[model samples]
Target: MVQVDVFWSYALGASFASAASRQLKIKSNPFQNDYFTYTLLYLSCIFAPSGIYLLWQFPHWETMQVATCHGDLPAWLVTIFSITNITQGILGFWVSYQCIKAGRYYLAHLQWFLAYFCMFFVLVHGWDGLGWQRFLYDPTVLNNQLWEPGQHMGLTFLWSNVAFTLYVMGIFVIPFMIIPMSKWIIEGAQNSPEVRSTDIPESIQEIGITFLKLVLGCSLGGAIITSIVIYIIRLITGNLLISFIFGMSICLVSGYYFFFQEGKICYDLFKKLFLAEPATSQKEKS
Candidate 1:
């Protein structure tokens, strides 16, 4: 939870700072903007409130090579951790500002995206190198039987599972959602100048299609990008950061085109199969 909230704080800072940046045809969506801030802020600031959460909750995993117990959490350590989160948020904002000012909006997204994912990797694998220890240790899990009558792994096990699940949704899953595309849809509503009290969809099917398109488009884009990038990186330098950097760069550049195309494909299919037209469209052609 400590790592998760802190990461969201940084990501929230970066994502919000990318305001007013221009893409070729892309305009920021008002609804998407509010939604983004609301979700991230609610999880990060409102929930645990990172700083206080750290001081009171203590840390399970060794962060920066230091470990502390719950009740004995050093004020100084908490202070430092809190400072780091603050500084990280500040830095994220700074980086995003520069990126957006330079017309590199994708880099701004990368700032937070990279931080959260890197920390996630560290949190999972770098917890005394025992992240995988509990998973395969269970006899039932190994035997392909997940649940049993008696399972006692204590608070460490319980909190780790619960926290990671929620964090994954907040940090990873939410980002891949078609918030940006929905923003474009909102832009269409605004520019059209037709009567519209709201451009955002209120129905489940409409919302589901947006998310479904985002996932599929990004999946296809990711697979293609990975294949090309791995080949090039292997031929050059096979650094982990280099791979990640390349992956994000391509996603912003050529990858976006693919997302747009793939999203169109999904939406067209949905339109043909179910939706007569956009659910929000009330204006009739004369």
Candidate 2:
């Protein structure tokens, strides 16, 4: 039920800002435009939701170019899918913006991570090659073809894949570190003196490039380090899941330091960007 959509990414991005916002928190809202939140929220709705709709409606749309099922996707489905993605994003902004207005930090965090965590299974199992079924419903998570660049290694051989470790860590795991990282940011931000006002991002119509930079920075840093940690653990643990599990815990500690690890290259880049302000006056701004 918990679809891996932009919702999780948005939540993570929001949490990152919100957690850091605790530092910027004033008794009153800054009421400034938060392109970060808006960008993530919008991105989440567009890519994952409509993308999933296309995949579901077409079944194996990825294979459509060569497969006989290419014509199954209807123009109606396209219309509906586009409609739903936009509407869903708008609805999400409404609800999340309300929570932010009310300072319900934990409530918003709960909404995202609850579903985000489930994706780890999909990430792991997905590379397990074709015929991988869920324990209960027995659904095909992946239908990897031999001609495809993907390999046929299930969980058994997958755990030891160095490249695969890097791939998953970069795209999914490191970005995932945002959840815990945001938790710390929230706590850190909250501990500061309350501010007078802050902007509700959704209320504003503005855009910028920082959101992409911020996500990529942390994801890049977190992924590289975490992948190394997982690989090291893999050498000792000799199991993909176990190695990843341990690596995840390691990321928790790393996440905290990354926010403050000055001059440390990749990790600290996240800190610099996360804690950055476009201008001196923008400190308390979202």
Candidate 3:
């Protein structure tokens, strides 16, 4: 049963990633100049259902404990975790791919790298649990030792920590990336010399609002959801401080970026929207 769950989860993750990648390559450009927006929409549609399902089907307390105990988690719990991780990776990749197609390669690559890194971590950790019963039930059992010290020092532990760190950092950094891009994209659209006098400013303002919503939705929403999950996991595992730090770091970083950088973006967006129309109208009248 455990093996079946693991296989299914891997299949789902791979299938979702492949589908999302293909969807991102479809171009409805000029009419829709924002590849990021389209990709984000697509990802939200595809993965949001899985996320919601996970949230709803969250394991009961006893099950959570059984899974977290030093041995191989139950098949059901492994399936849930696998699905969650895979969905996260897919969303991150979709966001990155959109950015790259839109020429925002730095943000795109950052998101993509994070996505793959997270995927690697999920696979390693999930698979590590296959022989977990032996390690947890009998630590002194020599032949059953799943991980060598060198592997731990070199690959397993080191990479797991690295992946976790990156995951936390990526969540923190998302708001910062979105806010500036929002401002730039809106301002560029508004200030374009080719836009008509009446349409430019309104269109820009609408885009700005849309971007603001996207920032808030992804940053705050993700932070809140992640916090709840971490808290639950901590409760089950007795790793309170680690979970607190991880959750709080996300909130603090996202809050700082939104309050400072995003505030600036909002101000600039408003200024551009207000000025653009008048400037275009003046030229037309002259």
Candidate 4:
């Protein structure tokens, strides 16, 4: 708990610094604004709720667990919190995606955000082990399993709760982050003014279409790859933890490939969407 608190404090400090830097840069050159501040702010906002919940729940985990198990909390409130918790990391990625799509930052920043989420989850699940489903299915079962002299919710459980929350948060974060980032990279690489050094620009509608195509193509490819990897891992090992680790490894590799390999598969699909017509008209072409 202390560590987490300290972490938030450090983030707050960094946010302040980023804001100051952005302000200075804006004053010097408005058009040269760096989005580092906004990105930090987005990250802080996305995680604030989870951090608050962590602090509140760490000391009251048993009570909350019992409440969740018995449906003691109001159904609507429970649903809302569940959704928010589940989408915390995703919220961060979404903010980054909006920035990237709007050309607020470099492609690398988007990749960094996606990579951060992945590493965050890797740390989380690696520490907590993979009994999360069991715990969710039956809190009482977990209680029984942990029932022993001097064995109760303590520092260890507190840490585990943190990991569990992060894992849930990461479920949507990684996949969504990649979609916008991939599209932006492909578009920027080919016809963006930054790359082409031209005055004319691509139409918004065309950009949107290309983005959608990349998103759909990447989604299909990722799903297929993930499914095959998980199936093979399951066949090789009966242990959930091993399967999970391998699955995560595969995902990380796939993410790297998609983000940096120029997304050729999706690029091809984008071209097909318009019958091989240019997705974005280059300045020279225009």
Candidate 5:
């Protein structure tokens, strides 16, 4: 299962990155874009179920008011937040496109960042809204009134959110960025050996390889650990929300340790077994 998780993560990251890169380059090089286009179609097919599930579970206004922020958000405020989120996302893309047309890369990035912030807030608000279900399962608790938001529950919700955001960044966004950045680096190196030797030294390349390895390990190990923890918590507590929170905690800790510590050690050991003595010597300082 662990190996399966690792393999799936690597495949997904690589495929998604490659597909996105291909799409971006399609305007410049339309030839042979068919393969990636087909890949994207298949990828979308695979992701459709998950997307459907999310939409199915998405909170309505009644639940959103009680589940998210302070547990008493007015319907008008929720409507405003939802509208702003959607509007900003569309505007942000348009602004980014205009900025790129004007060759203002930094400004484009800022616009995109603003869009991301709006989208993230909306997502977190939805997750917080799910907290309402924590009380729904209890027959003793009245369904008429909103449950009081306790400090412990609020903090746990916040922490789970932080973990989930980081997890997505580590496993998804990073790979997307890396695919393009690595292509740029490789192209630069090919065009100018001097740039390769000076701007991106062997040490830097090794560091990148190590980081990639850590990410792979963390993606695999973290998923396995999180699943096990969630399963155990659910069995013991018989509460979906509590189990999810506990799972997020375990996922965060295991991911951190694997990415920063155990993953590096495992990568180093693997390299030692396969790499030549000269290669090992170059890595020794690291």
Candidate 6:
């Protein structure tokens, strides 16, 4: 818990600095802007809730005892976890809002729907994992033997299954949507007459490029770190499914956005280098 708190603090500080820098126009590279935005988005999704919850309700020591004993966290911790879950939904809404402001209605709608979906899952799952009633109610009876007593039964498990299923689906689907959408936006901007016409200072552009590279490096590095952790957990427990599900759930929604989104932006820049035609005119042709 202490480590998690420290991680959140560092991420929050970095996000706050990046946002401030961008608003001040200190970084002119579109890549820097893209990197900062996605970094904030990921932090908001994963850490904002935890931070907010901690601030609101500090867990008592006794509560920690119960959690350690049962392998289930106390209500306060669950509340904090919920804060984290709900904040992700808020981040999704913010993303949709940004897309709309940028005149990307399709992307905006997509993001909005996804945000709502996330919120719904958080609500139904009770944030602490108790909302899976179906599994509790109808136990899967096999050979008149109970593999594990007091385990989830029928419809209770069904709902839990649904939640997991949605999470799994998001692992692959969200990246496909976000990666292309970010690419289109960044590449589209490069060809804009206004962006091309603006006399951006070389120093600013250099700073932006540097920042972009840093963001890209950080994102990829984070993914690698997350993968290593997952590998270690699997090796220790010999249960890959739970680890994979949890890890992928966190990664796809958080780090993957930064990686693929930045990749799209970079790809756009390369496209502009090779294709002489302006992106706006190309859009018209399409």
Name the candidate that leads on TM-score: 1
In model 5, where is the ten-residue run with the lowest total lDDT? Answer: 1-10
State the C-alpha lDDT per candidate. Answer: 0.44, 0.41, 0.38, 0.39, 0.37, 0.39
**How does candidate 1 fare on TM-score?**
0.43
Higher-TM-score candidate of 2 and 6: 2
The prediction achieving the highest lDDT against the true structure is 1
TM-score of 5: 0.32
Clashes of 6: 13
Candidate 4 stretches greater than 4 Å from native: 1-201, 262-286
Sort all candidates by TM-score, best to worst: 1, 2, 4, 5, 3, 6
- Where model 1 places Cα greater than 4 Å from the true spot, the runs are 1-7, 19-51, 58-68, 131-286
Q: What would the per-residue lDDT of candidate 5 be over residues 111-210, giving only the tens digit for each residue?
A: 4222332222232322433332332222112233334444223335334432343355356445544444355334434443222234332433553464
Question: What is the clash tally of candidate 5?
Answer: 2
Q: After superposition, how far is residue 31 of candidate 5 from its true place, in Å?
A: 13
Q: How close is candidate 4 to the true structure, as a TM-score?
A: 0.35
Error of 2 at 235 (Å): 2.9
TM per prediction: 0.43, 0.39, 0.26, 0.35, 0.32, 0.25
Q: Which stretches of candidate 2 lie over 4 Å from their true place?
A: 1-3, 6-49, 56-207, 260-286
The runs of at least 3 residues in candidate 3 whose Cα sits more than 4 Å from the true structure, single-residue gaps closed, are 1-72, 115-286
**Worst ten-residue run, lDDT, model 4?**
15-24
lDDT of 3 by residue, 1-286 (tens): 2222233233332322222222333454312434444333433443334333332332211121123332444566555654554444444544544553454433332343233323332332223222222112221122333333222322343244333443564463344344434454445444545445554444434654643443344333443455565556677777767765675566556544763242454334333322333233457768
**Positional deviation of residue 38's Cα in model 5 after best superposition, in angstroms:** 9.7
